[model samples]
Target: MKVVIVGNGPAAVSAIKAFRKVDKDSDIVVLSAEEYPAYAPNCMENVIRGDIGDDALFYAGGFSFYEKYKVDLRLGKEVVSIDNKKKIIYVKGGEEVSYDKCLLAAGASAFIPPIPGVELGGVTTAKSLDDAKRIRKWILEGRVRRVVIVGAGPIGIEDAETLRYMGLEVSVVEVFDRVLPRMLDKHMADLYMKPLEEEGIRFYLNSQVVAFHGEDGWVEAVEIKKLGSDRSIYLPADMVILSTGVRPRTYLVEGTDIRLHVDEIKGRVVGGVLVDEYQRTSDPDVYAAGDICSGIDVFGRHRWIALFPTAQQAGAIAGYNMAGLKVKNPGLVDYNAVKTRMVTAGSGGLFEEADESHTFELDNQIIKIFLRDGVLIGYQFVGLPKVLSVNKNNPFLKDSITFKFTGQGLEASGVLMHHFMRYRDRKVTQKVLSVIKNGALRSLANPSHDIPLFSL
Candidate 1:
């Protein structure tokens, strides 16, 4: 059996290992456009912050691991086209390879807006290892004295915090009203923003960068338009870092027989090549994972849940089925854990500002939850440690459950009973009740199973 996996990120790496586990003698080939070995995309910001050195950013098991597993690894080679009918992939350097099965784990690219002067020097996005090295070099050389970041998402905010720590004058400009609009609600975002502001990071909310001004082929200032107002303002800066969101890298699949979902308003391919329960694409031979594919979420909606853990799950399932194994890949639920000065974790759904069906309370250190249907969909916690388990549950749920922080007087047994009863009644369905009950029984019997319910 011959298998070729594209993209060489987390999803591609996991697929190779999974194939080897099932059929050790299967021929495996990994293709990556990046010149270096595979590394975690999430660690790019940390590398800039100096939390991890350049060499430490690579995966723990590097090229030697692929050699030990007898997998062929190809770096700095781009897979340009996939011919599903012929089962062949065309490369950039006039090379072609045929595969018995292929996994398309090609990830996303950083989205740069169509603003004038965006091509000027000192403008970059943190998408790959090379991007990080360039940004780090600019910072260490003191070439970036005043930095302007163009997005307020998690990556942007983390970059801002790290840059401030490095003694650079940093500012963040976002078109959204609040930071992390996707991950957090206004109340939760306020909690994070207050601390970051105190750390000397300036934020310009509801603003868009219209153009960049440069001198001697380098950025000098940015012209921005405030939301709901036609007036514009100019801000001086030495460098501009685009921390805007990413779009799926689906261009290679275009013009092929593969069908893609296109959004008329956005004017780009919105979702991945559609797939069914078994991770089979429109073309049976081609399978996709990670940001390149869209799947059904726990809420029964088709969404692109692009996270590292979700990508890994999708890749593993695709690899198992591609190897001719009979396995059903359970779809993913929306879950994220982020830690700054405090820790916040949530799953399933977020209470957006437009969501009238949800009611929430935010006080000094407590978060109260309620659902429009009188069930609990979500909750947020700050400065409170005891209520951590109250928020954790199985990923799937039919109805919501309310959560209230009882004082420290609450007994541990009582808390466990509350969780178990909720899990038995509201969270788990009758079909999966036996599995949940048996797992709970095993967990209670073993002391080693008593792991912390949450971690940073």
Candidate 2:
């Protein structure tokens, strides 16, 4: 079998590993638009902050990784289009190849909003190593002193912390009422306010950048408008960073015979490539995974969640199924964690979708768990660690805790998924029921051991 996988991110790497495990002799080829090897996108900030060398960014180091695995790699090659009828992929400069199976893990691109002045030189994005290099160049050349980040998501928050650590005055503007609105519940999000405030990062919640102003073709300031008010403010900025999330790079399938999942109401294929439990696309010979494809959500619905861990897991599953192993993704839940000099917070699942919620608060610590029908569904941990005995001096230095409810690794939102996959029709004994009722989430960590799974 000839397997061709596009993309060089976590998904593509994972697919290569899976395919090799099952069929080592298959003619496997991988294509990447980036010249560099696969590196952790989350660690790019460390590269910008000078905490690590550029070589550290590569996950497995240079082209030798592909060569070792006996997989043909087309680095610095852009896949222009695909001919589904002929089973051929066309690359830039008229390069073409035929494949029995193709995996579209093209991933996503940083979203650039329709705001004016974004074309200015000083504005950058937190997407690729190239963007990080540009930002580093600007900083090293002493071109930027004040940094304004537009968005308070994980990427925005991380960038703000890194810039502040570099001695640049950092300010964040978030459209939502709180930071990490998609990651944590409202109650849990409040714990992050004071720590970030103490870190000298200015925040403008419920506000958005309306436009950017530049002098001599470089960003100078940003014009922001507060929601529900006519008030507008201009913040001086030598550099502007757009952390406005990302959208699936589904352009490859456009104008092609490959099928896409179109929203019936919106009349658009805006979501992503639709894949079944096995990550097989509408084109039986083709498959997709990671950020580029929309898969099953925790609640058994179709949703697009482009997260790093999710991408790796989905890509591995897609590779296994593509290798004819017939594996499924189980389900995916949103898991996110962020930390700065002052605070650390992690959350999983859709707490707002829960029917009931509970909170446990102490000085500089908070834990909120959401439940539906007496079953644990979601949770958020904020403030200092649950216990500071591990590191007394630094309350912020705590191990990130992940509860394992399923056979999979530590999950942020696996309660519902565990029940759905393993305990859907099982009965809960009184002992197991009592343990769950008493917040026995820690007991579920040992998936290999006997901890009765709870049912809803």
Please, what are the lDDT tens digits per residue for candidate 1 over residues 1-456? 888888888777676666667777888888888887778777877777667764567673777768877878898889888888889888899999899888888887889999998999999997778888899898777789899999987678767766765667889999998887776667667765765676568899999999999989999998999988888888888888898988877776766888676566888766876666666678877788787777665444566767776777778778887877756666564444343322232223435422233222323232323233433343333322222232244221112322223232122222222333233224323322232233342332234533332111
Candidate 2 residues lying further than 4 Å off, grouped into runs, are 53-56, 339-341, 362-364, 385-441, 447-456
Which predicted model would earn the best lDDT? 2
The CA lDDT of each predicted structure is 0.67, 0.76
* Model 1 score (lDDT): 0.67
Overall local distance difference test of candidate 2:
0.76
In the range 274-358, model 2's lDDT, one tens digit per residue, is: 9888888889888988889888866787888888888888889988888889887888777666644446677766676778776
| Total backbone collisions, model 1 | 2
Query: All predictions: root-mean-square deviation over Cα?
Result: 9.8, 5.6
What is the overall TM-score of model 1 with all chains considered together?
0.80
Off by over 4 Å in 1: 53-56, 262-269, 339-456
Residue clash pairs of candidate 2: none
TM-score each candidate.
0.80, 0.86
